[model samples]
Target: MEFGFARHMFVGALMCGAAAPALAQEANASGAATAASRADGGGIPDIVVTAQRRSQSLLSVPLAISALSDETLATKGISNSAALATAVPNLQVSSPYGSTQPNFSLRGISVANEFNANQASPVGVYIDDVYIAARTSHGMGLFDLDRVEVLRGPQGTLFGRNTTGGAINFITKGPKLKGTEGYLEAGYGNFDTFKVQGAVETTMVEDELGIRIAGNYEKGDGQFRNVAPGGRDPGGVDTWQGRASLRIRPGNGPLDIKIRAYAGQNRGTEAGIHGLEPFRTGLGFFEVNESRVGENQTDAWGVAANISLELSDAVTLTSITSYDGGKQNLQQSSDGAPIDVLNINWRSTFRQFSEEARLNYESDKLKLVGGVFYGWDRIVTDNSFYIGSVLAPGVDGGFFQHYRQTRRSYAAFLQGDYNLTDKLILTLGARYTADRGRYDDGYAYLFARSVTDPQTPIATTVPCAGAPGSCAYDPAAIFNLKGRNNALTGRVALSYTFDNGLLAYASYNRGYRSGAFNGGSYTSSSGINYVDPERVNAYELGLKGRALNNRMTFSAAGFYYDYTNQQVQDLRAGPVNILVNAPKAEVYGGEVEASLRIISALTLNASAGYLHARYKELALQGVNLAGNDLPFAPHWTAQAGIDWKIIDAGSDTVTFSPTINYFSRQYFSPFNSENAPGTGQINSELQQAGYAKVNASLIWVHDNLQLRGWINNAFNRKVYAYGLDLRGAGFPYNFLVPSTPRTYGVTARVSF
Candidate 1:
């Protein structure tokens, strides 16, 4: 995989906003709407958004954003950012480490691989003004959410740092305006998964103030096995979470405040897979009744504060401060089994503190926003291991390594919109950030094999140490790694418009993700410092408009991303894996969307995107691989949906919606396109060929009551979703992650 990373270069200048409202439509996974309309008003309802440090209509800002209505979230079964892919168009979701984390990409870009607080997500995620520093945190279930806005492209202006591919804002609902209300949801699905959720809101001080609390409990039998000769029930973990908030209006003053706190816990078995050969893999892949390895357990907690105040006649100031914490301890497993007994136990923890302040100034012809942000974080990880296969010693998984890191970051930005004419608008934005990072990593390894089966010996032709064929295994030895890194980065943009609904935009966005010591540092042989940051310069253009009596909406855009000092993972013979700054790359693509109200109660929406995604260049340590299609990146994707309101049952309304999506086959590994077994050859993923899936939902909304349910993967089509290479033999050793199966659930909410 090529890591398209860029180092740091700071640049900045204020471009005041004195223009008209921006032109863009926000779509959540479920419903669709361009303008907010109210029966009470002649046209659209005033959508008050804090996206620019001020509550404004969606169109007033020059940005590409998608919003998921509170009702839509309930229909799609999306509790956090992980479910965002179902409706947001160009978003892709995956969990590489396990179900415990959410790894995402907006337009084929993502964060560098690392499990620590020092590294920020490529696409930043924020909830109620407080930022979620790690991707894992994004997996937490959301409750009492009012709306979710997905901002596309660069949003460095007036936002906390780290958004290279845009940002996602999770806005929760405020105190009930008419009084007390709440909801509850419960369901059972495949994998013996059981889930329960509930939320309670109360008007503690009548019309003066209120409080809300929500929580979730989920458990299930995992899908992997632990193979140890006469094995036991390997690893499978279940988790739970809770959240609370307090909203205050304080005697009609110009200031209002909201405070929230949360906590979570998980306990289960650690079950990861490993390829034994070609046919099947995992704990039971070898047809074993059981395996010797054991599982791990985990738990964690945190808090946040958000405040809004009107300082004077035209200037409004807002402040947000938060602290997040997490911890996990597990007895893990690794890829490839040299066998003799190897046991790894790891404990990881994170602490992050951040503060942001912003002010918005509004006027008749121009509007502007500016903000300052500072963040401090630290992470500590401890690893313990015991191996008896190589048999050089018997500490039985003794203290193997201890890792610690500290990171501090700060940023300042401003944006302004100018209405040059009655119809023309201009927008400008800029941001500057400074970063400092440091870490300490210590690791070592001992020899030990899985006592029972003891790793099988390797059989291969030896070219005789000095010959050219291959090196044969002599006396087995343990492997280990120890490494470290640090860095910084910054961005700017400008856009213009005209009267005929045509718009043009240009932006310069810089992104960075710090390097880290791959666990490889545990081995005794090689000494590799760390992997460097992947950076990108993005340039783009597009158009947005309404047509046919405001019944149809359309938009089209193109973009080019230039990458520098990319990171590439290298897998040599044996179990030696390392990361290095390889050759550079360039990506080109365009996206288009169209929606029409076919009839009064029916509507049609569709989107298409093409990415001429190529490496442009892929040189390793100096070897040029100029024209390779970037690994795992698909060239094209398209989605379409239809929603119909069948009945407006007087006091209730019922709507049924169906959606279908398609993604061309993507490569599983860079070297394997022909689907070769041992030689790692697979021209392209055939089993995962471009396929389509259908999903539908039934919703019933009535006075004081809302009932919703959905059915997914309706056809039960089996598809190869994701896999990894364990050794040189292409199909010899690998692991597969399956897509979730069908599920159906009902949620009920009442407001009085």
Candidate 2:
């Protein structure tokens, strides 16, 4: 994690970007069409995308999007959503607390605090057209997926709620109407890991009905062995999931229907933290010193239905309905030491239901899509914390909280593209959304200290019934709040496509994120229960094209955003953080992506992103942070890779792929202080250093069979993925979550 090493890697990536064309030239000098060339037919494969609500070639789409196919996922060892950060530019995903929750940021725009269930994310996440409402479930297994699409701009039209920072769509493999196919894959890796995945699809009634089934199971030992007395192991994966889908289409009819159901459960060790005690412990990376039993258990299930009807030769009507729910129970040590002074347990449940209908019309000169959506969500949570004698004398007690929240939303949108000429097009889109939220009967209490208690002691009544100030939480304390807001967002664009397959476009979009209540742990107090909505107006210009007769593909874009009433998370007191609205902010960035098929046997890919994000006007608690950089906003992010095919024949092929991802130094907190620990600093000196992760894989393919051996984090670099400053809580410690260590594994797969 040295600065010198990071600089070298960054320069190397730029060199790779410049050498792609030269490599293509050298490949042309050799006159033979190798077996690899014959396999690919001497051209880059066209990728189909649905970013614009329609099926089109990726090269013709006028947006900044990064998409990965199923094949690419397997070759790159991208097993979960967090790993996707390595493949996409200007995108970051992390688990600040544990593996159960995932936080995503696009272009330095993200939810500042993710600990509360009532907070809404600016980035939208969807699965099979159904918006995922719970942040905890965003880390679900990525099995049997057709594609993962990331749209990097404001998506206000023809999409669900809160897309101010863009959207991520997970498209799963659906049932086939005319064919039967399936695949089985199994793998063995480090930490005693064993995993299996299988998927099958068949046409039950020959072009009329079809069915598909998929399942996944993985289990392993903990990554970090516990060395503390009475400490439990952490970082183990024990989960299983299954999915079933059905497709019904009457013979040659214009109507089609799809039904899908899925369920998953996990019971394993929870996530732990490593405290940075440089002077005493000398950088503890993979170990946690805690005297508690860590447990992270969860259950999730959902169902969805999609109906499409062709009203005419040029028009179609579609209806989508979905229901999703998840439950979690987690317990972990919060002190990151063996003192047993602090521990947290959270039990929560979430459910959401949504319905959407859209009308689409396509013709030679015009394309139009309009939609209306309605959604309802509910959450119930019970959180408690334990305090021991080590932290406070005769103050050993637990704080218990219970709350319920419900939200209802309605939205309508319209978008159209009109071709003014054969190569010129004009696009216009708009959406209007209204949201209503309510926090029902809620209460909390703190129990009296018990000297002989081995665990948190629960009391039936509040210990401080009349004197509420003596206890952290009280049953007499009650909160019933409601909030409502409405917004109108839109987009406009102009585009032109040349006859030689080059497309360029310029666009402006306005998007908004809904207002929310601080209804969870921090709402028991007065005057800080609600925060205003956030809005962003973004401008983007982009170019996408193919050169060398479709052998090389490139995309580039520049963007700027104006933000208002931005929601910022801040800590007011011990264990009480509130979301506040900032006056204004500005962010600007650019990105470039390129892929060159140097030869039939060799291909090169590289991408880089630059960002300059700062707070134009922000004041909290009499402290001005107008000139500070946003949290987790890195100046540069780059990735480079090379794919080589050693042998390609009718029945056999061998290939190797190596990739490296680099990220510049980034501040984990907005305070951006670089002082020594215990210096009464608001922001700990701990920052995520610039680092690189090297990954490689080798594959052997024979007709319908394949074998892959891969290594991730090949150098076993001690990189920090997440960090938290806890100086305000009387503990001068910075907890760090390290990246996974080097892991090598072998996977075998077969297709029929």
Candidate 3:
């Protein structure tokens, strides 16, 4: 797939110059207005968002964004972060681990294969305006959310560093100074799955103080059937989370404060791997033969405070402070075979603290926002790999790696919007960021053991002094590494609003991501190399408006990216994965989203995306990767859905929703190797073919009580969430992580 610059420019020009008048004319038509009013009573409802650091209508925002409210989330079955891709155009989420540690890709920009605990993702994740430094913690606080906003393209101006792909903001519901309210929900599903969730809110003082508490718990029997003797299933779910929030108005003054605390834990098995080679056990699909069952044990907690003080009618000051920490003890069988080929054990702890302060000024013709931010994070990992057992019987060979990494970031940003005329607006913004990263206490060791007695090591080699054979030591690797980066990023945009309420915008933005040391080094000291930071220059044209007198809402955008020094994880270079930077690349994409209320009781929504991402210059291990497609970037993606209110009574209503999502064929590696480089045979496992999934739900509501029956992946499609090529490591098999199978459940809820 290829998209040229000439076509992009031509389309942009058309959107900017010709489309406005046509849209305005259509909106002014009397028949359209009458039809819209008769279709949905008042047309589509407006959603207020904070994409620009201020409250505004979603259609009024000049950027490409997709927002999902709490009601939408529940009806769509977006219970976790990975499911978000189904609703948003040009967005993809993947992880080596299932349902957790999600790595987001926006507009074909992403961290392709890096899974080290110390490395941060290029796609920034935020909770109530606080950045989450740890990737493993991104899955938390997904429950009881007010809305989730996905900002596409470069968010450098306001979001600051490490947001080259984009950003996801999860805003939770806060306590309201009103009457007492609460809700309780419970569900049961296949595989013996059980779930319970609830929330309670109360006003401690009339219009002065309010508090809210929420919790969720879920457990289930695993989906993957372990066929090996005495082997347990590995895809089960056992997790629980709790949160408490307090809001203060302080005598109904201008000072507003919100304090929130949350905690969660996951005690379940890891995702089962599926091998693609013939040498492994001949098991059926969704069946794994493994000697050791992996475990997924994690604990996370955080606290945050947001304070806002109104200085006057046109000026306000806001401060946000947060601290978060988590720990994980994970074990996985990498080869997916009954034989002990490769097993990994990881023990890690992470913590982060952040503070941000901003001031906003709004007037008739001008608006300004400025902020200063500081963040610090640290991660300590003790990881071990058990290898060489499959090739050589009666001998167990393994290696241990220990490292501690700390990072500090400081940034200052300012943005201003001025109305050039009654219908024209111009926006300018910039941010200066400085980052420091230190990798210390890094060392590794080699050990050998007899298979008969795996508990004791027969031979051990330690590389650092004071480090015993049992692998306990500090910063004595061969060298300690420190990286520093300073960058200036910004955005400029021009927008026009037509008389018929149509918005057209064009923008240019620059985005930057910090550099860091390779945390995946385990074989030798030379493997711990530093990768340079990446930068992107993006240009975009977009249009957002409501048509048919508000019964139809639509948004369209086209974007092009000039990317340099793109960071990637190269697994074919050696036995261990290495971080490297691709010198140059180009990406272009376009997306369209629309929703139409066909009638008062029926609505239709659909979205489609097209992407062209390719490397312009890259050569690794004598293989030229130029003109190859980037990993995890599909050329085409689309989704369609319908919401129909089939029945309505005096106080009772029933609705049915059905959706389908489609994805084109996509490569998992940059090589895109069809014949395994010089072998004329077919390597069909390198890519996933085009696929589609179907989901449906039926909901009934009666006053304060509700019931829902839902089914996901109704056809039980065979799909892989992640894949890795082990051929470079002298293995004939490739590792593939399969997605969840068909699931059906029924839920009931009561609200007071």
Candidate 4:
């Protein structure tokens, strides 16, 4: 099935490429201005990216990358993390804990359905060059940004930590030393949603120091309706975040420094889940019958400092230091039912510190970057689960699990690019990483109805130290475990630039992800056992260029990966979820993105992707999962959009932008079960069928003021963003999280 899809995509890409030049030529014959002459008018604007730790033109970089400017973000209505997938090809974001935590997957490489806050995602996320270590904090810091760059494939050399999938860099706007400037925006939308975002910047000292402050606040009544009697609706949105930045450059000298501090909190209702079983509820997809409504509360903050000094004409030294911490107290009804089948309260706190120093040297023929990094992080989790009402009808039963983990990482990396000739370059990079961690203070207590009290449940603690059948806990569980790993990873590539302004490249990379202890353990310590690290060897070929006098710009890439020891969360292991290693897997994909200026008043853009990811050798107990598709990996993804300048006048212009995105069928679990007897379905309920969404925006600019109206998911397509199988827990249903429905709003912004 996947092979045929790949062939069709390849043919379609070739046809599009063949037709673009003719259209551009026709536009040129109509006396349209060259793209370089009217770059800001309608042509595809040039983008500068820092994918290689240095500022370079996106078209010159020999890698698969997609960059979106702040203007594009607003025009496309991409306000949050999940919306990013709609714009970038082969990118997926799934959030089990609502908008608080999002797991990013690039090209079929992802963490699967692991809801543990302590585990780091294979896809590395960064903000202004500072790596975010915890997935809980990844959802924050999306507001008031300059640009977002998504680099596809393995980023093993410069970003050597856990970039087995890829990397996303969210570069925020900084303070400019040019007087005072600011912008303020406010909007109201459906579900009684109100939003306010703004940023202000000022110069503290002439040519020496500048300061910037930015913030975002949003509140809504929620979209999910609860149909159960006297049940309050869930899925509301209430969150606010703020950031402060300072930039210092004494006498406009080579000594540059930037310091930033940010904080945010979410106090909204928890995201609602839908049960797949017919007996659970007869409510609609957007209606839930949850009896116990919960709240999603989280507090996060971080501080970072970036310093750089020029030592010589060709040498520069840079240092980055950062500290981040967060706390989360979340209550959830996992069963999505009126009865107390599965209720959970999660309490976790995490802290991390990192320091990195690197030296960059640039000469006429060679460019080099070398760095050493040291990082430490700790997480403590105390979770309580209530399953008594479902397991034993009248008896109150539950368990409390407490665990703590401290991890340290050290690494040294070096990458250099040498110009073999005027148009040919050779790139080689390597890194050595050592990861060490200790998991301890892990224990669980099972409780039931007290003997003295019949109506109320009391603390009837039973530890795993008791005899067989005495407690519902695994006896062979190890409460304390230590793990260490040392490995080497690198990248090598050769790129050539044509005189016609085209860049072609081929490269190979080795990526690695550190082992981790499962933080979702509840019944037994064995659930928290150490899982080995995963590795991947990736190869890629790519092209980036322009056609028909630079009116059309495009990038294309094809890649393949040899994966081993992929970590996957196994929920079929009796009563407790375990982190197991998939012996082997294989992945291959291709993507093409292009933009063309049809005329001075219109620009058309499109992108398409095809991925094939499957496990080659995987078996658990007696069930074989070989040839099953990897989680969150869709076989096909596509997007088409247009930017039309319908009106243009002095100090006044109007633009209308519309986009459509599509995704093929994808599974959320690794099992990819073909039959679910409980639901009488031919396939697993944890899968989402192919779907498409439409988004559009209209903006009118008059002098320093701009007004805009936007809508997302205009067709109101019903789809699932995430899912979990509960059959192993003796439940006859699957928990599913739905994507946002149709939303519309209008906003006005004033700039100075």
Candidate 5:
């Protein structure tokens, strides 16, 4: 559970990757030259990525990155953003609130336990070069996607919005210029899960215009058996999504434009929660006793337009514009008991608009890219709490809060790479950003009335402590908080390429995250409403190479981060949650990824990540947890897999692949407590033990058709995704959200 072990393991992995080829075969110039020339002979296809805003080889990117292609995602059964955490190194994903709002962490940098609708996350999410500012919609389903790229460190230069932790880019397939193609897919699994998807694209006007359309629908029964008295289904999902695109090539010239529109709807029951004492009482893993099982409903839609003009072979201009909006309604029980002590209902809606323009120039000696970005968004949220059990008999009472906020941001950035020598390159990037945020209106009040009274509760919408009807709304009271700031961030890198396609690079980057208003009811208890920006300075060294006649690829990186003004969730006198700035923190880690083709029919893949994140100076309330690790940060994460083509027909093939992922024990809270003192009872019920799971899939492919049978979490291991301590809210125990159990399914697809 300590960082010392992780460090040692990381060094061992690096040594193994660096010396493997040398030890396996003697060094020879002729052999290295032959491998460098075999670009098409590989275990996996060459992955081209846009991590730096341009198409390039994945291995050539200077930053630490992990990529998943459409085929890879399907084979691995990764259908959403949250599942990506299990496949990538140094990454962890959780849904403390629900699956619609996922929280992500990379290299020990994360934002946990803060759910203010107006506060943005440090981890940036982008689709088709447009930023998604709300966490609620970041967990977009993966359908008809080309690939997904995860950049592990600071991305403050090109991606300027809140990118202190890093960025995730979801790239979807686009329309073909002169082709008529499509695909159909269907799947069935245990738990009554069913899915169907289809896509089509055609050239409406030969080489002048093209159109594409796609859609997906999925539904499944509850993974957990709800045993609550008189409770309905509590853990099921129903979702549908649709997309359309038009690609225009005017006069068959160099001017091209694409317009894309998409919409999605989700309606499902909330996740089930288990009490801490349930396990001790010999109950099932997911059994719960609750009188009220809440439901979740959401609607989201967006449109994006992209225009590209090739002024010359060496220069081009591009423009991107987008608008996105979403609304959500959710209600859930807080204590997970039949006699509910607290129930919460949350309603939220948000809208955003963004515009970006870029220019590019490239030549044999130098390449340049620059862009300007503007974004605006408005968010509104309402939270209502029903506390009937805590009030006097027949005296139903509760609290209500409502808030609205707006944010505007502008940024300009430029990045260029120049060849210093035939073997060395220098890269420089810089960006300047200005941000403004305002809390337009906020209101809160308490209401109490006798339940026996025939008349309903006459609750006022305005904030008032005096008698009823004597209340009024205020714009400048204590809630009209405004914040503005400017920041400059950049990146510097030096890379060298050898004649044998080997690359080594070192980089330094400064990252920034903007401040925002905390739109919540906490102001009534703690008088806190605003949070400050956070910053990070990072250094990295990396190496990438191909060997064994281009059949094997290897990569490794080591990084260090000096973080200041780190934002964290804190508890005040009323035990109310709020966002506060931590003085300082530090994180250092290393990771290695490798893929080897043992033979033309068999391949092996492996990756490992290590991190040691700690708060160098932190004081919360009266407790000082200076050396404690951040929540959700595990010391080590790793995965290994093998793909074997057991049978090969002239025009058909059958393959089997198995993968196993492992993670060290992780703490869900800064306290890092595991068990009650001098007892085996579960006291610090907010930690997950070290565990591993195995997954396997068998696939048959013939021409343009495929059939697959897969099983995930094969052994049905019991794991917890998140936890909460309910003792402070008059509950006698804690609660845990259980992870999905074993699932098996069959899928079929056809393409023409």
Candidate 6:
């Protein structure tokens, strides 16, 4: 059957549906009255998510769900999902292009390179049932969202075929009727940042059809100072987005359909994170006139459709199918510094295609779910150039090259839980997938050709670009290789619910990440050397509960991961680039979360996490990198916040919140044998210092009119977290990517 909308009735059938808020249960004085065995929103809606590729409640799924409410997002300075990783437990995010593009990871299992959009992210990010495909795909996806759910664990059950580590799903707001409502917000902050966003929704046919549309635009200056010739000045990132959606519910039937379309673009500087020098057991000292490099321009868009139908009193059938895709072409200079220094330049472009189709049937006794998924990605060109011989900086040698990779994947799964009794439940799921991909590498250079004298030859050099012995003039050189791999994955879970709203569960799951050949120096030739996919077997225990009559909720989980034949970055004997598969490894971590409402208008929330990710064993042709700390993995993180309101307000309500976030120190450059001397890694910085950030915001609401102001990183602390230097020309301390600094802005919003 065609899972996508039917040709003849798709549009018409969708315009006849109605949205009804969740049917709330009656409550008693002690707060028990607020317990929601189900959601309390418009229409008796089902929480549809591929958490395990099934439609289930946000509370009962044995796994952990770190959900951020739409109401909460607006109150805080959180404007995008990428900024959420650090706020969520055990979840971490990193970006190359800018803060807008984030690569997500859970319990510290992130894939090293995301240059290939179609390849897989250790953690999958999806929107409205459609899998996002470009490396730069969902960077601007934070606007006009309903809620965001971050699911942590090896999701081998049901989802996009390539979710090996975890998954994040962004659910947008649907059509709401009975009231013509929408809001417009405009603000100006640090770096001369200017932003505007607005939305509107009204009933077109009373209780039958409804439509809503929203749009946003944000621009700011380059934050860092780049004084180099051909180098861009700091503080320049501009972005914007637009979205439209429609809802239809058939009369006298348990059916509803929602369709949405969205588009966004980004154009700015792509400053690679700056690197740092080892502390050398000394105090902090500084330098003047540092800069960053490169320029980036991107465009992305997609569409999604969801259909829900109740077949009977005990069964409901839901189908969600969507086609989503995008592309990004970016050029950047890596580690160039000290204004006017001719340095290394790199360029990359990616295009991706993804699709997912699933069928879900739910009943009081048991839930049956199954689905099929596939995705394709092509990283057509990845080029990096060095202005001089890398090791011997003064030698006049230059080289440029490109690498191409294509990753294709397919998967099938069956999952659900069967209730044995009112308090006991059994959950199980299985998945199998076939994955294949290839890597192509090549490079060309312009430099002095070196040779040994024919007799007692001291090294002699010519200016020929070809024939290895002459420098008079010649051009180019190439290298090649090929690789292929396939694998199967699965998961199982069990949980028990108490008389109260508390649940406990245990699960064992599998995760897989496809591997690829290395293109060190960006010049290796084409090869199928797509290394074998890495696999993980995880064991976990979790607890989920609702207290104070559902006014307060708490959830926690801990897990241990065992990996076989792990795929990791390996520096070759000569520092030339390449990736390899290791024999085995063990990684572990845990996360905790809690949310509570102290009073009708006051609430408190906090989350803390810890992870110990290391290489259990490593070998490069038999030499070992065992016990090495995994790069970029932080050991500890915490986030907490509180909300307060002013009462006795006539038609006017005021709310304020202050938040704190922290991350422990993490290593960026390898300090172990996993990376020996010659590989480009040796000179790389050792570790990125951990730091804390504090932010607060104020909001006033007065019927159709709202005002908000915020200041982030209030102390103006300079973070060494993402030091990126385009002006230092191999200078130390480059991982210098800056979080917004003491930014403050006010926005006026109106709704009609």
In order of appearance, the predictions have TM-scores of: 0.79, 0.92, 0.93, 0.93, 0.92, 0.82
Off by over 4 Å in 4: 1-10, 17-42, 276-282, 449-478, 572-574, 675-683
Model 1 residue 627 lDDT?
67
Q: What is candidate 6's CA lDDT for residue 630?
A: 63
lDDT of 1 by residue, 1-752 (tens): 01111000000000001111132222221123335432132222334566766665554444566667776665555655566776665666654334455656677665332233234666778877777765556766666678888876655556676555678898877675347777776766555667777788888776568888888887776544334544443334377888888888777577778888888876755544343443244424312222444454545567887887988777788888999988767654443243524345666687889999888787766777778889887667666544442333442222244556666777777777666765555666666666666655433333223443333333111112221113333333323233333323333445554443434555555565545444433332343345665666777765554444344555556788776555555543433345555457677776665555666567676666566555665543233556655544556566667767888778989888777766665554443343323445333432255565667778787986766667676676544545554334222345444454454555454554
lDDT of 1: 0.56
Pick the TM-score winner.
4
1-752, model 4: which lDDT tens digit per residue?
54465457556765665554455455454433444664765456678898998888898899899999998888888988767999999998888777768889899999976778888889988889888887777877367898999998878788737578999889999987779999999999999999999999999897889999999999997678887788667888889999999999999999989999999988888887886365344677777887776888888899999999999999999999999999888888787877677777788998999999999999999999999999898989887777745536686667767778999999999999999998899999999999999988776766564222322323222234332125544433437879899889999999997655577899999999999887776655446678899899999998876666566888888999999988887653435667888999999988999888889878888888989999999875345889999999998888889989999997999999999888888998877865423433333778898888999999999999999999999999998999886665666667788877889999999998
Better of 2 and 5 by TM-score: 5
**Residue-level lDDT for 695 in candidate 4:** 98
In each prediction, how many residue pairs overlap at the backbone (N, C-alpha, C within less than 3 A)? 66, 0, 1, 0, 0, 72
The model with the greater lDDT, 1 or 6, is: 6
Tens-digit lDDT track for model 2 on 208-266?
89999999999987776667777676778898889999999999589999999999987
Give the runs in model 3 whose Cα sits over 4 Å from its true position: 1-24, 28-40, 276-282, 390-393, 450-478, 571-576, 674-684
Task: Give the local distance difference test score of model 2.
Answer: 0.77
Give the backbone clash total of model 4.
0
On lDDT, the candidate that comes out on top is: 4
For model 5, how does the per-residue alpha-carbon lDDT over 605-699 read when each residue is reduced to its tens digit?
A: 88889888988987754457689887788889887788899998878999998998777877776656633222232436788987778888999
Predictions: Cα RMSD each: 8.5, 4.1, 4.2, 3.7, 3.7, 10.3
Question: Which lDDT tens digits does candidate 6 get at residues 1-752?
Answer: 22121211222211211100010111212213322342241111123444555545666678878777666676667776667764687676666556645667677677543233334676777786566756577566466777888888777777675566777888887786455778777888777888998888876766667899989898877665544444565436688888898888766358878888888887766643443333212312212133445566677777777777777765555666565555565655444344322344444455556655556667787887777767776665544343433425454444444556677778888787888897788877787887767655443333332111111211112111223223322233334445566667777778987655467899998888766555443322221135677788999998765554455556667789897655455433222334667667677877767665667677777777777888777765245667766655677777778887865388898888888876776654334323333323332444556676888888888977888888777777766434222222232334345444467888887877
- lDDT (Cα atoms) of all candidates against the true structure: 0.56, 0.77, 0.81, 0.82, 0.77, 0.61
Least accurate 10 contiguous residues by lDDT in model 5: 449-458
Sum up the clashes in candidate 5.
0
